[model samples]
Target: MSRSLQTLRRLALPAALAAALLAGLQAARATEAPVSLAAVALGEADYQRVNDALVQHHVVPRYQVMAAAMAALDAAAGRYCAAPGAGTLAALRAADEAAVDAWMGVQHLHFGPVELFMRSYRLYFWPQGRGRIAQATGELLAAADPASLEEQHFRNASTAIQGLPALEVLLYGEGAEETPSAFRCALLTRIACNMKAMAADIVEEWQGGKIDFARTVAEPGPDNPYFESAEEATLAFFQSLYNGLELISDARLKPVAGASIEKAKPALAESRAPGRSLRNVVVNLEALQGLYEGEGGPGLGDLAVRSGADPKLEPLLRKAFRLTVETAKGIEPPLAEAVVDPKRRKAVDKLLTQLVAIKQILRSRFSPATGLPIGFNAMDGD
Candidate 1:
């Protein structure tokens, strides 16, 4: 054999080894942590009933309220297609609430078990948020002569509850006041990502034949099994979930709203310089708030199904739970580092800290099956 041929063979062996390593890495990334859907399976008929209840009890009431609001807002929409000029928006909001009440009444009238449905399965899917730019854009799109604003809004709202991003909104709940439109889109995007996390649970259950809805939710005890250890896939799933929560909390995940009160501090001397009028600042802030809190989105039913029952589902839920806990803990520091204004930063810092606490509490009180940590208790199961 020639000397060159020997060298080529040596190089080829390492190349093959490198290729093998790369393949392993990719395989790890694709292997998902298992998630069980046994609890979601009530039976086919029962599952259908739950879906029906979701639409009737949770979804319908939400839609009724939103539709009423949209009607009033659209009525008030002038040539500019902006909000109404008179008491229209206020009255409309009231009407929407009343309509929601009426819808709720109807649910009770027929199902009678509506409250149980709401408490048992609805809260998980409800999106209780609002924003300006996205709201305006949504309104604009809805009022665009050709489309139904209320319908579009309903869809956006549905996506929100599902934890999926809404129609145009991007991230869900973060960004500059001026860029409400862009922020809206960003907010929706993040919400969609969160839904993707839930989707993992759904697909797992579907595959297991446990989520028929007709049967009652099953609980998988200690005897369940596990799948191949795809740490990389689990990490990616966790990352997506964390991104969704971070977007909700830090608001950094959304689009950078149009230039307004961004984080940058003017030069120290500039700080001494006159800034935008105080009145304008106040107005802008109010407008921004209006955008954030005005709209509604999708909602979850009030069912607390266990994800860890089946051998396949436990790892995914556990992984997801762990990710959620980590996200709650990590929210404050980054925000503290980012904000330039001391007062604003301090306020946000406090708010984020509270949110972290709330999330921790929710995890502890609500998450009985996942067996992940709640703050210090998180170490309990591990």
Candidate 2:
């Protein structure tokens, strides 16, 4: 076989493998459910689509690009090493350019799609993309041989990824401007705020980690420095929540709104610990559930109106509660098992069973009225 054909064959395997790995990652994300404190949280399907797009186009393509670029570089290096006198500076420069171009071509294909995903995420989980960008930028900065061919290739890659947020804004923001409705404006400003907040959070998390770069960026205060710097991200999350509130006109929305607004006020005004903020969010959800039950909408009317508790909101609450319990399950076995003894586990299981029963009750009682799923739009006025 010709040398070129041989190289092509070698390149094909790793490229295919990279694509397969990326596909698996996307599939896993698609199958998993989202963790949310509120009933009106962003849909799991949207998150999965954004994640899959990022992985398939940008992230997955990155592996193949890096691999191809490296292989080409290595091939050139082998020739140079074997006949050092024959390989001129011009020859090395030409080879390097070829590899960089190849890498950039891969990046070009992936960049726009990934940027769109990041923009969508900014509408919901703004910090996640920012975290990734922050981590990548730090790694790029910390590399020792910044000018070496390997480092140069990575530098190109890093810069490409870093450029995504701004590109997203430029592309999506301009369009949003032409038709600036409350929703568009809210979403655009939210995206902008999220980018900065996400970047700050990323820096804080990097600093928190044991990695050398993390130590270099370390701040003196707060358990989660990201949360401290994540004001805009936190605000944007709440703004989305506010938008959700506007969508529902139920009387129950008033208290849920009150509680959400109360919690959001603190987060927007000052930087608080993420743990505290998250706890407050859970409280808001629980409060919303209660207010929802009290509004004379459905189910024996507020677990209080009947001999037994109403189960209308129970299923949604149950899912949220289960997510919390399941998240805790990932803790070290000794800690988890100790914190949640067998009795506690049994209690949780029994509660989940009750939640299922609640779903049945709500479905039978309310489905006839709404002609929709039991939980769908059941909140008063929704």
lDDT, residue 149, model 2: 22
Worst 10 residues of 1 by lDDT: 268-277
RMSD of 1: 19.5
Candidate 1 lDDT tens digits, 1-382: 7533332233224325334434533443254223222333323333233334443344344434433533343333221124332354344334333322322222212211222323212212222344433464455434443222233343344322322112213222223113334333333333333333333333233224554211112222233222122222122222222333333443321221112237333221100111211222122222222211221421111212323223322332233333333433333433323244454444333334333432332343223323222345432457
Q: Model 2, range 45-87, lDDT digits (tens) per residue?
A: 3323322333333333443444454445445544443444334
lDDT of each: 0.30, 0.31
Off by over 4 Å in 2: 1-120, 123-281, 287-291, 294-340, 374-382
Could you give me the TM-score of model 2 versus the true structure? 0.23
Give model 2 RMSD, 1 decimal: 25.9
